[model samples]
Target: MSTPGQPKDPAAYAGPLSGRRAQAARNDHAILSAARTVFLQNPHAPVAAVATAAGVGISALYRRYPGKEQLLQKLCADGLRTFIAVAERHSDAQPDPFTALKEFVRGIVDADVHALTVKLAGTFTPTPELGELSARAGTLAQEIFNRAFEAGALRADADANDIPMVFEQLTAIRLRDEARTAALRHRYLDVLMDGLRSSQGAEALSAPPPSSQELGERWIAPDAIMD
Candidate 1:
């Protein structure tokens, strides 16, 4: 005990901390991989069940992923990477950027059947992790829009900076129940694309005169006043 001045046990200091960090990383990976399987098979499974499936204790799971929102946020972000890879393949193969952009949008819309998106949109508030996912998604969407813009697929007057934000809003709406079931979402998306098209093309896709004042009010702003 009198020899305490000689650099007391470095191994004692570093061992547990290093092991804990490694274990945490391993546990996080195992849990997420297990969650992916459980989520796919039973999207509604309880969090405790996910922890059980991962072969980790509930406390360990919580230590790695604090709550349901965090878990789902990570899941969606992971899914987006896979989804984007698949979408890029299709988008890159198309000859026309306009067709490619439309197909890319369609592919994402059709592929939203993954339960994580459904659960996150319906249940979770936007936490920091979710916000981070959105930020990354914005970057990916910008790349897609930039490619389209370079190909002259978007109107020259429109701001390329606005596309990702606009796309996010539209995608959210498309994921809603009423919006998802009907062909109405596809029609609405076409109208949105038309709005961003060159003047001649926009005029061509313009629908027949509004059938009623209600329809007119919905399509054309009642706030629009003539001088």
Candidate 2:
């Protein structure tokens, strides 16, 4: 028998607790994977679809996510974190700062394309947490840009803030089919990279472009028009 003042054997209790934690981790991973797959195929896919894809019951999914918005918030946060990590890794690994910047830009675009809901949700209603993630990613991007400029790989007139504008332009490319969309995105990315090069034989831009804050404010979702 255990003493009244002493605890039970830690190993005896650890088995059940560890099993529960492992199951919870598996459920979380499955739910997130299912949500990402569904969202990639159709950003407007219902929560039921995610549950079905995850092989979990609706109740189980709800128990973990509470609601669709909460699930989306988690997905967005994960995607943003991944994007920041990729940018940091590329920036640190590449010897050529310009190549690093290009890879960073490509990484962001790839993530944005895959996480369509996350990208669109930001335009309509961004949570403070989401904004914070974006700001952190932007900081890494600015560092890459500064390094490229110092290395004479990027044009002196290029603005770090223009990175978003470049992404916005890339996102505007639409096609009737996904295949064409992917192809065009790559082609345009190459064009954008060329324009960013220091060797571009053109006069320096006369004025600065709009700030990132201004761009964000201007992109508020349109409300219904009254007759």
Candidate 3:
């Protein structure tokens, strides 16, 4: 193997991709990012909306995704994987518990993952792979929550179930510019962290935090809902 920072063979993988391949990769990234933003803003939007937002031709998009369900599946899978990767990385970097928790929160916000749930949830049945990923993601997130609480970094009244709802609330804040909205959301996240931390003057929550099952029940498809 090569040194820690060096590629095993730079010539094989580090140089520019072929013109067509490089362009394809860029287009794919643009399409998926645009799809996430567009669909989250309006779940009922047409596939052509994604193409327009991505600045690519409709044919190009159809060639890659074939249909809106496929695109939604890919976007949600990407967001889930992003969450898993962030959690795994931070889990290994165990320093100050609350600081790690805050970093984890920031990483998720940067991913802007909760938007997928806020709008596109239940739009398509999840694939088996997506189901597996969701299971792993939940485990990692709860581990992070447990670590903070066990270390007394997090407040007793703040349960792990509060995490998703807080992130979802952030997703509801829309602005004309993405960067501006992110900045505002992050500013408020700092305020949230202060409240979450265990403090002498912390007040008890008015009600119990949502249970994990209840938080999860929100994603159940309309067909699966019961009286």
Candidate 4:
């Protein structure tokens, strides 16, 4: 069965696999799922922690991912895919702009996208593939925000560039129980959503909306990104 951090298509990996390779695929799934948990809890964690968490030998973990940087890249690439999928799904299918935006926000939160951001940002220099996917995700997110803004749903003061920072703000609600942590994120997200809606008497933002370049600068050109 599919689990968090596992590739979406389990059966069709790198063409058909021999029995031994099939076992390796299964081990890969376990390794990714465990790594997600271990690293999210602690980004600076040693590689052995992932091996122990995955219930695999250290050698097996290394064989699958040459190093922690590779592992971080894979995890983030998976998260960006999820983020893009949710944005794409809601970008056109929903008729109500605000509702669509809310659902998209909820989907990403459910996917634990913010947790990945809170835990893993800057942990590795992203490969070119990851960088491309990140840019795609950002474009989709902006499209979603623009739709809401054009429809007079989202506040005029906030723009798509604010989305990442907004999600990062919500990532502060960590708790011992992951479920509770998720619940709290949604709870605050709902509050933030209310503030984001266009409404009378909502003061003009004291500061100018952040430029895309400002946010883009955070992810070094030498690398890749979030939200």
- Whose TM-score is greatest here? 4
Each prediction's total of clashing residue pairs, residues at least 3 apart in sequence or on different chains, is 0, 0, 0, 0
lDDT of 1 by residue, 121-177 (tens): 444445565556555654665567677888777876555444433344454453346
Each model's lDDT: 0.58, 0.72, 0.79, 0.79
Model 2: residues >4 Å from true position, as ranges?
Answer: 1-21, 109-118, 122-125, 165-188, 203-210, 218-227
Which regions of candidate 3 are displaced past 4 Å?
1-16, 177-179
Summarize candidate 4's per-residue lDDT along 146-225 as a digit string, tens digits.
88999999787877766776677777677889789888989988998888899988888878767877765655532443
Q: Write the per-residue lDDT of candidate 3 for residues 1-227, one digit (tens) a residue.
A: 32211112323445788888877776777787678768877887999998999899999999899898898888778778888988888874868888888888877877777767557776777889988999999899899889999999988888888888778776667799978998988988888888889998877989988887776676678889989
Q: Is candidate 1 or candidate 2 better by lDDT?
A: 2
Every model's TM-score:
0.47, 0.68, 0.84, 0.85
**Model 3 lDDT at residue 197:** 94
